[model samples]
Target: MRASRFFALRERGTDARTEALGGLATFLTMSYIVFVNPAILSSAGLPFDAVAVATALAAGGFTIIMGLTTNLPFALASGLGINAVVAFDIILGRKVSPDVGMACIVLEGLLAVVLVLAGMREAVVRAVPTSLKLAIGVGIGLFIALVGLRDGGIVVNDPSTGIALGDLSTGPALIALAGILVALGCAAANVRGAILIGIATSTVLGLVFGVLDGPSAVARWPTSGDFSTIGDGLAPGALRDALTWALVPIIFSLFMTDFFDTVGTAYAVTSAGGLLDERGEIPKVRNLLLVDSAAAAGGGAMGVSSVTTYVESGAGVAEGARTGLASVVTGLLFALTIFFVPLIAVVGQGVTVGKDTTLHPAIAPALVMVGYLMIQLVREIEWDRPEDAVPAFLTIAGIPLTFSISAGIGLGVFGYVVTMIARGRVREIHPIMWMLVPMFVAFFASNWLSAHVF
Candidate 1:
């Protein structure tokens, strides 16, 4: 009896060890996005450091909520779409006050809350066809891969020259790219902590090449001196005019992007993890939606413009994590990094000339992934049935070209509807799809009206 007890105890210990390792792996996988996202957003004049800290906390809280409510392993954060809107459109283009932006964020969160309580979340997911979900997953993968490639210097911007080779012959940039590529290759080959390894290697190479020298490299943690006025710079009343005009577009972009991004990520990660049940559905999806909504709401309170689920979390999900334990671990690690924001910001600035410079390494990876996914999509679609393939093909290609994911999706949906009508399959299409026609008309008409009216 004592011998049997000893064996049981040992088994329990082994299980615990396994759980711990799984959690740690998840945290490591997500850390890259968590760290880099804020830095990128901040370069556009938003309070990146504070937003980073808040996002981490919000993510942790939401993760805990999901675990308690649904028992499904998932985490949340400011989404890529929101980050782009905040960086490019709101901060730079419209010059809206960050305070007003935060207010809009809060409203979006409230809308998400309503969405969850109304059971719309699950209903929409259920309503979406599998083919669209697949396209979304592939699209997100391509999007993120493009982001990585651009940051890594594999792609560059030139209006006159168009797409061409970047300055890869340089020391630091070349070293960083090589290091990241080597690390990614290792990860693909089953090496653990691939991203961290890549970052460290690049950092070292950066130092050796004198790219990360001077005061920029030596700045202390939680660097708040330069941003002392951030908290006090609220021009809420002054922002109303701008906010009024921009609100519709901002909200529309945020909702469309976040909704699809979350859906696509959930589908992709669940598929990769082999977590889909016999019915090809994720279990306890309601709880995941709730967690996501709550995180967005929390992000608004913390002054970040938009918070949503991360599609890149698929990287962790692909690595064998099966429980919310992974999310919890990731959240905790992000919380700890709050103290090092200054150091990170400083280091980030030192290595990359500006925020755009930091984006060089990510560009190549993005292109490669997009190319790969497009190939896969072409193979999967029923090309002989041009009615189906043409629409899907357009959706896949239109996103990057149009510079708007929603517009791309909108075009795809419109194409699908037109094709269905042409093929005499109109009855098979959902009634909600009819809504697309008017939306398309309205969207383009508004653009035309704006050009002429203004």
Candidate 2:
């Protein structure tokens, strides 16, 4: 049989099975975040159970939106970094209320919706260079790896002790680290369900060795309470606070980070899943942005913080999820999990370390790998002619170090302008790109002044 004909037959033979497997895999991979983030935020004083229900509902709604509108094979959920930012940085670090923090998230969602409706997202995206997108992707990867390492107990903070080895020699931490490593290795080797398999195995081993203990360790899966109380903790006054000066930085941060993260994630996952065409555009960008915006808004109403696209959706795509059907399936599963919150909670609490102590050891290695990969990619760009290389490198490396994606993107845009001017190729660049420079500078300077002056 001809190759196309043979593949067609094969696709027909396994389409239903593949899709079912894809949906299940997607659920397993994301359920942890769906369950854990709310718990974490709630423990920090937000309504724990309310956040849980809201997260699931918002995620399901948005995933369905993405599937129906975009026809792209991807899933949506609460973002990992954004949640940490909301819970730790905005809420605790700045001493802001969770209500106010969520308000900012709502504002961002509104802004995103406006951008999508105005057709501005596509324009803004086109204005950004492809190299910059890649840089953002690599930077996020490094940042994520760093977070994992810190979480897994592989890295420790010691000022007086001065960088001593962490307790990798200990049992619970060691086992978790080992399990993560094995799963990551398997993922690299193209193993299916790598993350789910890793977490499950680690949890079981933790239970077996007494590493897993107590009720707070495992996450409650979902329950009737999870579904029935979606909008339990909203504070209208908090929304008003978000409308004030306190929300300015939060809004900017949310928009910049979510925009780049979503873009980079789509690119990486689509490529991995063989979904992108020759030009690297995921079809229906407009629809994707709309769903993302809607999801964030939904999350806000449901009493959670921000909801954005999941990079882990790549896992689903890798498993051969090809259409909205996959996302719909994923959404339904999330809705169904409402009844199993107790099981999720037990699992989350039982097999994990104390919230203060739980760590992921692979973070350092992952960061190192991402950094190396980024450097390698940057070097391949022709920098020997200073005009070609300096800006790109600055853009690539500056994000994580500065802890601001907008700053990094701004630097890249600024470099592009200077390079164009020096090379006498100024006309090729757009006026709007130059506009970003002053905006970024103003934002950064204001933030600096706020920190120092206030």
Q: Which candidate number would show the highest lDDT if scored against the true structure?
A: 2
| TM-scores of the models, in the order given | 0.81, 0.81
**Which regions of candidate 2 deviate over 4 angstroms?**
1-16, 47-49, 160-165, 214-234, 271-280, 350-392, 403-411, 415-424, 448-454
As a whole number from 0 to 100, the lDDT of residue 113 in candidate 1 is 72
Estimate every model's Cα lDDT from 0 to 1. 0.59, 0.64
Q: Any idea how many clashes model 1 has?
A: 24
TM-score of 1: 0.81
Please, what are the lDDT tens digits per residue for candidate 2 over residues 1-454?
4522422425433364566577777876677665556644764577556566667777787887787677665788787666766776778877877667777778788888898899887777767665666666666655554555555566565788643456787765576577677666766787765665666666666667776653442344555655443443246687777776645766877777787777766766676676766687766777777888777766666666667777667656667776666777888888765555544544444223456554432222333233333333343356566654656677767765565566676677678788879889878776667777777776667667566653
Worst-scoring 10-residue span by lDDT in model 2? 361-370
TM-score (C-alpha, index-matched) for candidate 2:
0.81
User: How much is 304 displaced in model 2, in angstroms?
Assistant: 3.2
* Candidate 1 accuracy as lDDT: 0.59
Residues 124-235 of candidate 1 have per-residue lDDT tens digits of: 7876655665565455555555555556665667788765556888654585576667676766687776666666566566666666542343334555543332322234
